[model samples]
Target: MKEKLSFKKGHRGRTVFLICDVIFLVLLMVCMLIPLMKVLVDSVDPSTYGLRLIPKKVDLAAYKYILSKSSLYQPLWVSVYSTVLATVIGLLLTTLAGYVVIQKEMPGHKLIVGSIMFTMMFSGGMIPTYLTIKQLGLMNRVITCVLPVSLSAYNIILMKSFFEGIPGTLYEAAELDGATPMSIFARIVLPLSKPALASIGLFIAVGMWNNYMNFILYITDADKKNFQVKVRELILSDGLSGTNIGISEDMLKNAMVIIVVMPFLIIYPFLQKYFVKGVTVGAVKG
Candidate 1:
């Protein structure tokens, strides 16, 4: 009778837990979706009133007005090119650093890895960084944006942990077949690490795509500034001051927000599978 009673209590507890879980998930969905719905509704609508679930009338003038501007095209292209270049270079450097740091037999491995970790907690101030960039003749160059932020200590550590999870036997087999460390990394390790690479690459790409500070500090040329910088200028200043567009300021802001976010929305679905796996795999061992 006691055992039966205990089982009944346990089952009741599980039922309560499941209900709470469902409630929490529902609340989370509502929180995220409501704001997104508001943004979507406001983007095309001219309503300056408080948030609404749906706009009474839909208008495409805001989008049309922004798209008509020829100046936006250059910044869009600059953002795309810079993001792609930075993501590629960051992955290469991160993978190399990760692989080297995980080799137990390598001299000074601990010290090297430790130094990389130390950077996660600290960095030189903005003035010093700017001076260094200036001294290197990187000022006002697009490459400055790519090179300065390429190395991430967190990415290297996550990658190192992922490398450590690989069996030592695989490295031994490759070595016996006269494979150099580089060959093993390129042919074997890289192929196996697609998930991690995709995850880190996505993060780097998104960061580079949204980056405004880099342009503000390093890039002086208006022609070289990326989309975010342009968007920021539009947000801070009166909307289309010199341009003869008649769109409302709120409408333009909402439209620009959607325009800026749309690319990431389209791209993320394709990479979602790799992303989930990558986040978990690197985290599991490290």
Candidate 2:
């Protein structure tokens, strides 16, 4: 009923290809690992100067400068505050909006969805957005970071795609059991949407956490300067000369970059399975 598979001469060629591929991948891994190792070494170097793979001396003044500064804590708190709010609000609103658009029976479903899709490709421009924020008195406020970017058309579409992949019979069954739309969404749909929620929530959290430009624009208060902004000024203006004698500018900068990035680097591995599953399912199902 089925022919036996044979490579014959092609087997040798396939083996050669595999060997080349592995070599190339190992080289690529080495290239990436080298730079990261250099950063780690330099950040702890007592007197950093150039690209160093080995530390001349191990000192943690770079990390200490940040941790000891009371003012720096404010920025860390701001990032956390904005990220948490945006993720929660974005997920709830996007999930509701995504669920509504998938109901073919709803009036103007096509129109509403089309309008949303339109905004993704076009925007009112930067000046208009800035002015709008200013007019709303959101200017110079910590919450400005959360409100302006709390909803993204792309995230909504992602949720919509994930929701559409769910079997329609589930909804019908829930309706027969006298579940309202809100109840069905809260209990049934959300329970099945963990993959999507994890993926999208991670995206929002990372974006908000790394949002440097938003703070530069909206938060002007001296006490409200975020972690990135503070580090940027330190590097640009010269090291905290009076306070940090032994620590180098490059060392502090590298340490700050690592601090911001390490959380996500640690987190992404845990969510990688769900993130890949969600995106793949949405792509195929949509």
Candidate 3:
């Protein structure tokens, strides 16, 4: 009759462990959610000095004031253009470089792979990189946003690992059918690589969207500045007191944070399912 119970002595330990893990996860989620809720509430609340879980009153004045500004549009366009362009270009380059690097028959392959990995561990300092950019005449241009960050070692490695897991017989079949390397890559490899592409594309897009340092350092033209720059300016300009935007500093800051973060929140849901699968493929591929 005692054996009828599923809760054996050893099973009790695992059950307790699971319960503790669930409690910890719940606490962690609450911690994260509280701050996000506070930000959302404060951004729309007229009085933003204090943190309140539930806002006493609703106000859209902060949103109206920020959105009504004319200068905001140019930076928004720049950000969108640069982010989309950079993500596309970077993804293509990463995929191609990764494919080439993974090919065992390619000559000097080890040296090329080593060089790529070497850059991952180290890089030329900012000053030298800036000097190189200057020499290349990339300053204050849209290309400056895309070119400098187009190739990432980590992304390339992840793509290579993912590609390595594809069976070689497929490629051999393609070659027997008179398919060139480019044709095989375009038709066979790319068609099977949605998860990897989505994962890498999302990473590049987020990086470009959040990039602030590059714009500040290299872009002197106001027309070339992106959304992040405008956000920074609004945050740092005495909390925008000089602009007389009619919104409180705290509220404006919160509003800007929400505005900047909104795109990623919108985007992540579409990629959420593929992200885990992509990362697992890249990480665990033999």
lDDT of 1 by residue, 1-286 (tens): 9999999999999999999999999999999988878888887777647979888899888888889889899999999999999999999999999999988789997899889988989999899999999998889999899875667898898888778877889999999999999999998999988888988899889889988898999999999999999989877877454235566777777788889989989999999999998888789877
Cα shift from native, residue 233, model 2 (Å): 2.5
The TM-scores, one per candidate, come to: 0.92, 0.86, 0.91
| Candidate ranking (TM-score, best to worst) | 1, 3, 2
Per-residue lDDT of 1-286 in model 3, one digit per residue for the tens? 5774555856988999999999999999999999999998998876656768788888777777777778889999999999999999998899999889988889999999999999999999899989999998888887887776767999999999999989999999999999999999999999898899999899999999999889998999998999999889867875444236566777777877888889999999999888888899988973
List ranges where model 3 is wrong by over 4 Å. Answer: 1-20, 242-246
Residue pairs in candidate 1 whose N, alpha carbon or C atoms collide under 3 angstroms: none
What's the residue-level lDDT of 93 in candidate 2?
83
Which one wins on TM-score? 1
lDDT of 2 at 106: 93
Better of 1 and 2 by TM-score: 1
Best by lDDT: 1
lDDT of 1 at 224: 98
Off by over 4 Å in 1: 1-18, 241-246
Q: Judge candidate 2 at residue 164 and give its lDDT.
A: 92
